[model samples]
Target: MKKNLLMWDETLFRDPEVLEIDYLPEQFEFRDSQIREMAFQIRPGLRGGRPLNTVCKGLPGTGKTTSIKKVFQEIEETTKKLVPVYINCQIDNTKFAIISQIYRKLVGHLPPSSGTSFKQVFDAVARILIKEEIVLLVALDDANYLLYENEINKVLYTLLRSHETYEGTRIGVIVIISDMDVDLSRAVDARVASVFRPTEIYFPPYADAEVREIMKARVMQGLFTGVLSESLLDLVVGQTLKSGDLRVGIDLLKRATLSAERAARRSIEREDICGAYEISKYLHLNYTVKTLKDEERQILRFLAERSINDHEMNAGDVYKAVRESVSIGYTRFYEIVKKMDAMRLVNLQYREGKGRTRIITLRYDPIKVLEYLS
Candidate 1:
């Protein structure tokens, strides 16, 4: 019994970082074709030519960001000619902030924090790329956030038109969109769309066998031998499929392993998995809710408060309720609701009735959302 227990200093994880959500694995399995396509698109930049703009579309946890990261890693290791910059659009959705990130990567420092016009920063970035003779490749991960904030066009227009502003400058963009419902063509205006044509690449959800393989690889690398059984691994895979996000499975494995270790057990048990899944299933919901603005959270609170008695409400009712507390118009309210729906925080559907009413419902438990917001 003592031998089966992990001491205070001992842990079941061989390498705990492997289970992390952001850790880049040495063996990025099952994404060869996508990586090849991305590399091919980026090949021109390696040779001092402009890389083709690309749109990587997929649901959350489908390796869209990872594929880009892998390619960017290779680009960094191989050459000084191409400068690959990855921007998390969720955080830096504004045009100034996005360009600042590029400037920081190239200039090795940030621009002045205040009182600087965007053109000044833009010109500085262009000048560096031209003088250094470097091709800039920027990856806007979670680009749908830019669309939600109405900054997509400005950001895209600036990047795609940078070459026109400076004759010797070359730049390319890879827009990684986790939301499949967002159509880039319709989202951008004609002027930006004419030059911002991107080759669309889709990453469908991993098949059941592929998920099993991925989970198995993580288990082997992250855990000690015999810490998790084959039966329990299958359970984790099923839960991952149900949530439709691979991050949940990876998180569940870590949680369940900790649960087992706490119980002084060498091998994971069914109860450990069952207990961890209750919290792990809400991983995506938790993250999405955290990224929402204050107004978006207020609207969610209204829906949660209403959900106690009514499971659904008319979109107009939600808009009116939201407007009473927040100073936003109906159009902005509608966009907020649509954005929430895309993030899977709420379910928005149109009813075939008088004048086609839009209905809104909370996708998660109201109590959980309120707790998170509070």
Candidate 2:
């Protein structure tokens, strides 16, 4: 009898392109047109002109940040005539911190955070720009956040008006928000709103065909030849479109590849893709839960329980339900629902004549929440 041995080659099946969720570029794909347009719009400012103030809106993972970075790279390669800066609003919320970030970018020195009003910082930024004779294009990702927090007006007021006070220098702001639904002109005072009227651009969700093309390319680059079949590709694209999430698709591809590798299989089969989908929900749930506070988690649990028990529960009904069952006050409960809506965990809709009530539906199944709570 001859001895039998199993052999598998893992190197040929590894994924070299799967990015950690937080790393911006490793998972970035497509959006070449948007990058070119942004670079074109900002290029003129380098030769003693005002850069176009642009507002870019898109859902998460739609290549907003990635495209901007790509444009910035081109900008750096082509010319030193303009300065590019990026700030994530969620991480740095206050006016002072934002101004300090811009200051450090322009002046190459970290100024102390005390004894200087926003006016002083603006002056410093203007002086540096004028001295270098460079135009400035600043991108504030998550701009909607500042609008709600009341800090937007102050920051925009300074950036927009710096030209008036500084003389001969140009500063343009590229405001990036999650969606275009926010009518900023109506929100800001007319005087400030007119100055920051940016050229608006919208990024639609990727079509299923586009998703398939992207996934196929990634699979080819990240996995070995003949590793994934059409069946796995179809399933991944369908689930991704149904959920309206690119992260879901990327995650599924990564997991499926890993599953095949772990099983010492040469190729990823349909079963591997199915297994990936089965485990994806838990990863998403943990991500969502990590961002929530204790009260917020309690409120979500309340909504999930009510939603499972009763088919339809409005925001008011859910608020009352949480209040009645838990010791937290009504005010806190209302705030919790609003926060959940912002997180995209719960659906909130306005009924026109009626108040805007939150439709209590979990983005995932209620079983996910139960699993989380347990």
Candidate 3:
């Protein structure tokens, strides 16, 4: 039997998808300066020369990815001389995987995965770009992962130093990072740094008015004319400023609209906004959780389960509980916990005194985590 859902009789949203984080609104706001800088650096490619290598730095939801994507869209429309490609490092992280993504972007389909080696794919991409007489610009979003795994220099060697093997080909690179102040000299050797000659462009946190302007555009596009109230807008903007992440406000608006719809309300009330704001607290993850080891995922799963009956857990006891399900030593268990804490996935704090040891706190909504993990 089909279960009945208490959906609202009145529609509160016009086009709900406009509130999504990934949606590209008709009007882009408060990023004109950053966009101009990116365009200036990449303009050289239009003249059949390699563009300057760039390092784009910003906190999460500070418009790093969105600006890159927007500028690339404009570049594609103006000229065919430059081919723009974007790769998320967390997802296509390996040397071969990264190369394969560039290849797919150019070749229109991925090369045969089973029979191709790194050298073959590299040569194939180089030949295609050179034969077409086009310079390729690659944007590596969340590039710090490549540095952490000791893979940045190796990948750069394949791209920057490829002229040694494949004559007459030139490539441009863009690295997007969350920590604007990372030491590139330490992360990569002198050769890679010299070849890259990266020019850093920073994106600052959005101001309250800027955040409101952004929300206003999305609301006009997404919500009904009379459904959203000034009070709800004020609440969303306050939460956004407090969190310092525009995505939090966007997420809260989406969830709050859904809450109102579910309760059969024509207009979103303060209670619906409150319910959504609660879940938006921990929604900012600058990078995806794709890098978690199998063992770490097991630990997350275990803790997520434990959170059902317990709000917090003693770090030592949680390790004991995790060992029953996953085959990891006590030492490695603590190591993984420390690692996740550093990555900001969960809050693992060390304790003091004779009896206290450590405490573990989940930095995400439990209901969402279970839905995502399970």
lDDT of 1 by residue, 1-374 (tens): 46766677878889999898888988998889999999999999999999999999999989998889989999999999999999999888899999999999988998999999899999999998999999999999999999988999999999998877899888999999998889999999998999889999999999999999999999999999998899889999999999899999999999998998898777899999999999898897788788888888887788888887889899988777777878999987888888888887889999998899999898889888888888
Using TM-score as the yardstick, the better of models 1 and 2 is: 1
* Per-residue lDDT over 1-374 for candidate 2, one digit per residue giving the tens place of the 0 to 100 score: 22221155335344455423333454455676676667667767777688888888888657687778777766777888777888888666567878788899877886876788877887787788888888888888878767645678888877788777888768888888874567766767877878877777777788778888877777776677777788877888887776566777778778877787776666777888888878764565666566565777787877777667675667676766677768887677766666566656776665543655456567657767766865
Among the numbered candidates, top TM-score falls to: 1
Runs in model 2 deviating more than 4 A are 1-9, 12-15, 18-33, 107-124, 164-169, 279-336, 349-362, 366-374
Q: Name the better of 1 and 3 by lDDT.
A: 1
Among the numbered candidates, top lDDT falls to 1
> Candidate 1: lDDT of 302?
86
The clash numbers for all candidates, in the given order, read 0, 0, 1
> By summed lDDT, which 10 consecutive residues of candidate 1 come out lowest?
1-10
Model 3 regions more than 4 Å off:
1-10, 285-287, 290-293, 302-339, 347-372
Q: Which pairs of residues collide in candidate 2?
A: none
